[model samples]
Target: MNSLYWGEGGRFGPFDEQEDGWPNAGQVMRYFREKSNLSAETFALLYSKELEKAGKQNKRGQVTATWILNMEKQNLIPLDMERRRIIARLLHIPPVLLGLATLEAVTIQSRKKKPMGTLQKVTIDLAKHQKSIRDALHIHRTSSAKNLMQDVERDIWTLKDIEAQVRGDLLYQIQELLLSNFLLATRIMKDQRNYPAAYRSANEAVRVARQTQDNDLIATALYTRGCIKAEWARRGTVFNGMFQLDTGKMKSAAKDFQGVLQLEQETSIHPQLAGFTRLQLSRALAMLKLGPRDAKVAQALTMVDDAADAIDADPVEDFYIRALITGTLTGLHAGGYHLGRSETLNAAGLPGQALAELNQVRQLRQGKTYSGDETRYQAWFDLLMSETYMNLGDYPEATARAKNALVTFHQIHSPRNMASIKDIQSRLALSSYGTSIDVKELNDMLQEWYKPE
Candidate 1:
């Protein structure tokens, strides 16, 4: 029952404990091979061939079997990130193994820094754009998303120009600048329901974060990526009228969310990031389209409960996060406990109690002036409420809410949600309510709104 985790703690049970208080990378490699019953010779040969096939050329020329044995015999840690990766991939070492960085880390390092970040050293002017990139993110609902994205993109280009001429810690600040701008771009794209563009922006944010090798920033990047993917999977997919989960994409999003949690266990994660990530992970797991009694459903419920508990215990007084994934999470979620009952019940296809949960949330929010975050939630709540009514075959209520959600999503330039509203239209189209005048009118409105430009 000894702890296996490292905070440079006492030696964990059954692990190869090095005197230097870190896992010996060389022994770890051997550990994986021996676990697989792979002899040194066979393991080395396989490693060599894999490297050759991948066209890897190390400083020691061709990696040989004898070289591998010698390294193991001497407990020589392979400082070369690539060689270690080839070994890890070939042998399938567990994560947290020393000498192994994520496969993404290698790609981030090898990819040349974008020339945009470089200045002709002599022309370096940090003052020109230093504050500009940071200011770009000071955005609110008053700004147009498209125009905001364009401005941010320009700011990113300028920041890159500033980055090229700096060295030392200014470079790190620029990296954060790049990460922040890219994340903002991802959000703007997702806000517009432009998932592909969001994906690209998220990818860049991850690369920059990895290049910095900062765990908290990396967690943030992964969280943002997971959220975008979740939205893309649920909203951007074409309507099949079945309301079936996009299992593959959903699972991918879950993996990304899970990766952030793994990083959390290994290192300190920002409280806000940790809280929001768990919320997103819970939504993904709950909606895995599994049976009610399935393991994922239980796991999903547990995650949300943990999130609520953490919020109550946390001391951070007044920061908020507007969380949305496939329109599953509500705004006003992060700094507080969002009752997961409604979300889970809705995902489980139990609309009755789910609607009640929504009513409860409404009561809690009843007297407050609708803040911007609440305004966002109101639009999404309209969609969720619409779906719940449709599930209960209450078309009039569903249509009214769907129409309301559609107008809000459209007004906010959220084409993704607007398009998802069609799923309601689709379900109603096949129902006995298919020929109702209100249904036809709703259909016509969607057609007109989504028509042409």
Candidate 2:
């Protein structure tokens, strides 16, 4: 077990010996080739073709079989982030799998300070607008969603103006719109259960980002796309096989995460956002059952841990981010424990710990008299606690938690949420564990409003 920090200069023998260490590009290349049923030569040719398709390579100069062999040897670690990203994308793998060094660790030979260019100045301005938009769309906003949406529309136009001075300004404008749409649409889609529309908006966001030629934008868009894709994948795609577990869409999601890995040098955005994106990628891989272990999982997990640690690093500066990151990591730990990531149920020690965090979230909400969506967030936490209990097979406790969610949903007039409670109730019924309320009472409630009039 060795340890290394991103800023500790050059390579470190590693982190904890238990840490999965660096992922070998050779292993990922081999996995994709075998899974696609292509021989070594054929795989390289196909992958090289794919890179060309993405406009990442000079079509006149083809990658040779010998060159592919050298990469597979795993001796030459990729020093260039761009090359690493291209390889990860071509191989249908996560970029974090490539093990590139961090920008924070890059030491400058001279101390000449370059003035912030127009592009940098414009980007900083865009970031300010982004922050303002985010603040306006705060979950605790007192204004109606319609009023908030009007403000969002105004900001979108403002984003277009700020982005207009840059090269490929139209594309940047579209990317900004897509980014805002991605966040708003995905949040609506998730809460409303409009998975198809959500996927469309998220994919559109990625498409716009790709057209913008900015790695940071591309990475952020991909990260957003990956999050939506993961949620959809877990629900399964009964209609379109294109979105199935093994399809390119999953790989696309992975590649987008890799995009983030590749653009590490251009991370002018907040470190907290970058870290959160990495976490989103980790969750995507987990849903795909392509965890960061075996040969290619280390990079993925490293990104996840580093991102969380980065948030933890500035406790005072990133207080909200730290709390959110801790809550997210705790949830992931509990999820992995339940989903067979480890054999020992209690080994993760996170099931109870996550509940404590949720309690904290609830207390934080209480401090400010939450209304509307904020109140729903509190109810959402309650529902998650119930689901966790169910995952732990604590039937009585799960029933109680679900009941609480049911009461809250009805009070809020949320039919969709009430339906989710019914779904949970159905699961409880399958186990033959009766709720504290009469079965007839529950049925009557479901039948009265949920049934079509």
Candidate with top lDDT is 1
| Residue 231 in model 1: lDDT | 79
lDDT of 1: 0.64
Span of 10 residues, lowest total lDDT, candidate 2: 116-125
Write down the RMSD of candidate 1 (Cα, Å).
16.2
TM-score each candidate. 0.63, 0.48
Task: Kindly report which residue stretches of model 1 are placed more than 4 angstroms away from their true locations once superposed.
Answer: 1-144, 240-244, 312-341, 365-374
TM-score result, candidate 2 = 0.48
- Please give the range of 10 consecutive residues that has the lowest summed lDDT in model 1: 3-12
Q: Best candidate, TM-score-wise? A: 1
